[model samples]
Target: MSVLNETYTLSNGVTIPKVGFGTWQIPNGDAAYDAVTTALKTGYTHIDTAYAYGNEESVGKAIKDSGIERDKVFVTSKLPGEIKDAEEARRHFVETLANLGTDYLDLYLIHAPWPWNRIGTRHDEGNLEVWKVLEEQYRAGRIRAIGVSNFDVHDLTNILDNAEVKPMVNQIQYYVGFTEPTIVDFSQKNGMLIEAYSPLATGDLLHNSQVQGMAAKYGVSVAQVALRFCLDNGVLPLPKATSEAHIVTNAELNFTIDPEDQEALRHLSDSAPEHFHNSTQG
Candidate 1:
């Protein structure tokens, strides 16, 4: 019973795979191509990428070359977040489709509340404008689901309070150490599914002795423990890996962690031994 066979129902009734193959820093050419191709061959039914990742073309090409039915794989991408205007939002959405060579997307997200360099500047009204564009595309059937990423409660509230359609997903920088209680609770409570980006904390969690101990108890790797931790918390994890071993092993979540140990992991004093915590990045 590998978890790769499992799926989660979104707020709008669209089903996405529980595990997602992430292509964040994988680069555009062979790196992204090979990783996405390997993930598909290894039975990954979900793929998450973004305009900021700058690898949608390669990711899409890999999926096309994999010989898998387009609809069989759940695909997700995001708007660059800086484009707060409706016109630019529409333009980027079209560009994303062209880059992926797909007419529609399983899911689409606003990459962030504000641009990367302008993190603290919450463009609430601008975000609302973009959200409305997303709502337009979603209603037109170009995107099966619409959502946001890296959104705190305040940013998400802008959409939830005024939009005709609420966000269906919120992709955040979640890991064992940073549970992001406020945003996660608000999103889930509002019927949005949480997708965890950097679930392994960019390889930081691989060295946590506490997590390692739990992995040892389960006879799995530290990555497996981290991935399962997200699932246990009702968050879908998007793990990025390039090697075939890692791409395959990442989704081989066949065993369940003990309830007691899970609680211990959730409340760990440190999630990754000084490497990763809430202050690291989001």
Candidate 2:
């Protein structure tokens, strides 16, 4: 089967496309629309966007223009990180649906445990309020599955302990040279699929000579090796690309890394000289 057609079933039995086309840094107008349209043309079945990304309208329009049935494609969007009120979350979900020109979302997520500006502040109570709203929507069939992004153990545990429904997924930053092993292990054990944002590490891995050497052995781009690393570790990868060429080739994951090479890739997590933290996780 083509990698594009492969999927991971959410805990709720919702099937999500393995490679989610991300619309993170893209602008809201023609850029977002054209990129999404290109990805769909190149055979990506899953599309990931966020309220914070400010391109939901364009992403939705691109999907509509692609001529694919809505059911044939899986769509996901995030609730803004700042929304802790139940009513606000509810209202936003409606707005998201309208923006997408759809009736139900394949998946929806809390953008983060805390607002983007207040990253580390504890929001146990507030997060619970948002989760309740997500739960309400999921139960109502408006959302097929619900999850979170950028949530660590403490954030996830708060919701797990307090809510009737556990988050079905946790989207985090995972790449060849970076990972949150503790959070990954904890969330998976509790039945959450880890969706990896920045799976390409914001194109940073492409400039690494060591990573380039490794990719040369497989005759695959560094991006493919990085994406396959996420898949091998059982994490879904959401990669963003604007050019048609990049979007087409990004989905090509027809090769696998041997155990020894995979180990070398894992070791780079700590040893890699430079790292970036300026990108948003939505």
Candidate 3:
């Protein structure tokens, strides 16, 4: 199948692929390395990983194995919440590059807004300093783009207020089941891209009745319905996979969803309960 490659123009003129291979739950080593290799060979030009994920070496190995030119792929990673201070943040970026076997990243994000009081509380006021450091990295060309993840409207606005280089993207927990329109609207207005992690709801919404019905009408899988839902709404979807079949399936997002179906899914989000790692156990 032909790979679906949609591009988004960042505020600074860098274009990133709309569909990225997310490596959140995947661990470090052979398995993770295999997944990254498969994803790249299957035509994924964008890869999303994090310092917290502990799989950068595996991802690096896969990229090396593919023998593909490094400039062709857009690689992204995050600064851990615990390392929010400037010196630690700078140190973390260096270590992240060493692990990924790259000198610079396509994008880098503040993993979260000081969650768990690791850097500071989510409501803490020190988060702006962290964002400032990331902004500096972007200016220095060490990181091509800088952004944040898991930031709500308030956390984002705080950064915007103090930032020299506006954030290029905001990676967040958004999907068919837990869509946050407010965040989308706010980010787009400011020219920051919204990268929707868990775009399939971590498989929680794959078998949902609404999703299933939509898929049947469109003659696609429920997973496709959810992924298309994100793409249609302008949120770049990052789907995870460790196998060839899953990677290929995700790359087949070239078709458009029906207008009525898109509207229906938007309404469904208002009533659907949230599902993720944190909510699943509760």
TM-score, one value per model:
0.96, 0.96, 0.93
Model 3 steric clash pairs: none
Model 2 over residues 168-272: C-alpha lDDT tens digits? 999997887677788889999999999988887777767878888988999988788888888888899999999888898889997889998888887785323
Cα displacement (Å) at residue 214, model 3: 0.9
Local accuracy of candidate 1 as per-residue lDDT tens digits, 4-38: 88999998899999999999889999999999988
Compared with the true structure, model 1 gives a TM-score of 0.96
From the highest TM-score down, the ranking of the candidates is: 1, 2, 3
Worst 10 residues of 1 by lDDT: 273-282
RMSD of each: 1.6, 2.1, 2.8
**lDDT for 265 (candidate 2):** 82
Clash counts for all predictions: 0, 0, 0
Lowest lDDT sum, 10 consecutive residues, model 2, at 273-282
Q: Which stretches of candidate 1 lie over 4 Å from their true place?
A: 273-282
